[model samples]
Target: MKPIFKRPRFGTTSTAFWAATIGLLLIIAAVAGWPNPVIFVMGAILLATGLLIWQEITAGLWIGLSVFGLLTVLHLTRAATYFQLRYLIYSLAFAQLGYECWRGLQRTRDGIDSEDIDDENGDGEEDKPMISLVLLQRQPKYLENMILTKVVESAWGGDYSNSDAQSDDDADDGDGFVVGESPMFVIKAPAGMFLVHNFDVPYWDNKDEVVEAIGELRLRNAVEEHTAWLSVDMLTPGDEEPDLNEAYLLVAKLLTALADEDTLAVVRPESLDLNVWSDDVVARLLTPGAYEELSLPDNAPVIPIADDAPEMRAAIATAQQRWPEFADAFQQRASHDKADDGPSFVVKAKITAGDSTEFIWVDVIGLEPKFVHGHLANDPVALGDLKLGSQVEFPIEDVCDWCYEKDDEPVGLFSLEAIRQIQEAQQTNEQ
Candidate 1:
């Protein structure tokens, strides 16, 4: 058997290949009826061939059925005896199986042509940490951005936009703010990071001319009453020299004079070691007898409005008769006790004198009708040591009720007048 062994192959040409394959299948099928162990041997051969090339086996079977089907139809029409019904059925089955195998082979060989494309979220790059200081000192010739940056970084670990507008930016802000020592120690403050700057007042001759002291007093008052922080400061001698030594003395004097435990102010300048503010400056302004109504500061001009002096009662009545519009303005203001013991009026005057402009308010004050003094906006020249009455042309400040309180930040001068009226009415019986 080893000597006679041979490997069978398919085809010499395309037509011959098909014919041989068909012939080989036919021979294998009929070989089962032969003598010896031929049927078993053929079965073994078929199984072995199928195992070796299952795809080919199934394809051959399909083709055989297709041919059988075509041949069976013709054979039946012709009444052919070669067309046995059982053989025809077997042929059909084999042909179908062979066609299925061919289709499977084509599908596997062709493969599912596809391209793998992946976009990893196309996960974006990680976000960057915020910059703590972003000072935009546009055309900042004098003020250094670095100074603000360091100041911010040294104290608070936050962000900074501008030197003044922190919190808005993403920069480190110092934990505490440092108060300036001098003329800059004044300014009206509502909120407190306890900071201040940006002021241009008439240049000061005397230290009192600087507004820091007045600002501190207002701050102390606000703090006691509202428990709010006030960044009150005026212009200092120079931006360069913060001189905390002088600052310390002045602070001690100012605090000792203004100390009201209800209000507290802490100062921290880079001039101090470590720049930490721990101590309290005395609230010297809190001295009991020290509380004085904000009045016309001494040296304020005196504009008399009386025959002997100004008849405020008659003048007010006369004003109502003359400037009826102002009369309405006054009445709307004084709702509760507007009706006097008699008639009232509104008096108005327009004055243009020198560089300073002022609004002089008048009504009955004491026995004489004098200038109504409260918080009046005047150019430095207006508040003067005037010569006897140098024909001082006194006009009302253009305090159109709208721009009265530094433009409504504080109430208008009228509110103060209302308060005065209340005070006067309360004290009239005493007088």
Candidate 2:
């Protein structure tokens, strides 16, 4: 079954239809001797309201309502002299404006609740995919031009064309550029049109899951404090399943070209999955078969360190000093959820055998005043007999760093921060 694609209905067709209808009615009223100053004022106000609505501006409704109320009071008080027929026509036009206002509010509410609406075919399914790219910084000024240029260089180069003007009639105002409800650029492709919009941070329904995904991707700090995001939505031409592969490829290309280190994360809102921008990941996305195959693992592989540096030693000293606080929180969480598996707790400690010492993450099962009891979370490269998941006990003084999942977010990863700083320094030096 073909998935139903849904989006906001405000487009060029509706805008043009309303404009033409209003223009024709105003012309007829003027020809019929209803061209008084009051009539002209009402016509101008109506035209202004239409233009505001075309730009998807919500303030237009209040403006339209205030003018309608003012005109009604003037007509009743005999302060303004306009023909009765003209008044009736103006009243009907105001009624249409009121309806548009209500509809716009409904659309806004729906968007807040869910970006992708349920299938109208009554299947209780939404097969269409929508991807959002979360960014730590505002998009570059020439993003629209960059997107167009990249699309023209892709395999589907000639298969797409810019349609920003057709999708949004008031995209460019006459005097100065007026930003509408949101800054967006539209591209018409063979399968459908792609709507790319830059907006403020969205309300994620699966916020905890998203946080968990970010933690797994080792990008918690990068996106944890983001203020803005970009959404890429595919609008199918009709009731046909969109070319999913093409959409993925196009999005991948855009990510490769536009996403910098500051580009924090990418997420499929419908599934609440974080995606890494890499060639291997893109190849997996383009593979055929079940969608379940595309789901990334929750836990990322443990990153290795060849030798402890000054930063690592400092992090370890800090963790030792803060061990009391960690123990208090760990005990509290364990007491709170004792009936269930409880929160995930891990501690990084040094393991020594003969002359070699290695630091590894240990899955904490219990904690004592002087010791931490747990199993190794990862394989040791230097240690011969110490395998992954091997039960181990270590002195609390040897703990280098500690972390645990709290509400799906990783907290107290001190060593992780040091690692990030070291890597960043290396990159800076190379550049």
Candidate 3:
């Protein structure tokens, strides 16, 4: 039997407090010349705490505190005479831990870097510009953490930022500077393309300060049709959300420059015209029953469904009589889906198209007409291209035998609007 492991529950603040307490006790015990076993246990507890709940600055502070506490205790007790060679070695270990903590602080300030590439569809090649691209930048503050801390707290996901306490206007106090919304633009002509450049706005402490920071960060750039991406440093501190209107205007000005091919030879851009696609055309393609009338079946059960369907047995029996050489083969295929209770039905028949007669398996599922309304199924390559998921009028002489079934119970699917309502209801229940 496999053993089940429950997730560990550790509150961030509580864990930090306990880790600091244990570290302090360990430092005191080591300095006070406590019993070997007692000092060893304290050291173990301190190590576990540091490993579990670690923040760079907090860990650094704890290490510094412990080192200073140990030094103070040694000075009080004549360290030269009272401390043995082993005790000196223990101090060196404490120094090492302190040094590691210092290194961690430096790493946190440096921040971390991450990169992801979007090659349009899952395909490797990047050719035409009809591809839509979006850039999402998650600031370093969110990602900078030790691997252990990240793994342990991954399930308890939350934004650990002062942004929550900050009012939108607080970041706006400086020189009316604001981080604007992500910019979106369309490049037409040579290739149809849509691009969204998401700019992260670091905390704007003051307008002049932010302006200087933006310059230092190299936030200014002309957007071109061929422009692949915009880069920002990990050290940049940005607001949670920026002003969209400003961002849109900034992109618009850049777009105008790109359109002027006379000056900029690389890009041959035109004015973005999105009104070309008519609402009616879009509705026809997306709205159920708008493009093609639905093909729904009546509730009437024309034949036994599933295993009870006589057509399956009849087809096999007839095949065996007509083609004795292939009787076993025919029976083998017919034996499938022989259950009395099932949503599917199996039928076999010889279909004639043009001059050729082909034997094929006819698999059918019970999809009530009401539930599958406004849907049409058609084969682009076949001669009878319009009969895929469309409504079928019953009593067709061509269909020698068919099993029919109606949906009397809910089958766990709904339209777009119905789905929205269900989601709202679920949210209400959760609340």
Instruction: Please name the candidate that would achieve the greatest TM-score relative to the true structure.
Output: 2
Scored against the true structure, residue 176 in model 1 reaches a CA lDDT of 30
Per-model TM-score, in order, reads 0.17, 0.37, 0.17
Cα RMSD for candidate 3? Answer: 25.8
Candidate 3: tens digits of C-alpha lDDT, residues 1-431: 11223211111222333345546556545655455666666566565555443443344345554653564456434434553322333344345444444543443445521111123343211121221111112231122223212221231233212111134344233221111122211111111112323223322224254333321111211111112322111110111122323332233333222222211111111121111112232332234332221111111112212333344445444433433222232334336744335443323333444554332234433223221111122211122433334333221122333232336542212122333454466469979
Q: Tell me how many residue pairs clash in candidate 1.
A: 55
- Mind giving the per-residue lDDT tens digits that candidate 1 earns over 1-431? 11222211121111222334344433444553244455444444434434333323334434443443454464454333543233333344344434434543453355421111112432111111111101111111121334433433333334332333223121233333332221122111111222222112211234244333332232222222332221222222111233333333332333332223432223222121110011211222223321121121222333322222223444344443433344344445456563453233322233335664333432311111223222222212234543222333222332222111122353222323533554466469767
Better structure of 1 and 2 per TM-score: 2
Top candidate, metric lDDT: 2
Find the 10 residues in a row with the least total lDDT in model 1: 129-138
Give the residue spans of candidate 3 off by over 4 A. Answer: 1-96, 104-423
Task: State in Å the error of residue 383, model 1.
Answer: 3.0
> Over the stretch 107-149, how does candidate 2's per-residue lDDT look in tens digits?
6556532234344542212343443333333333235544544
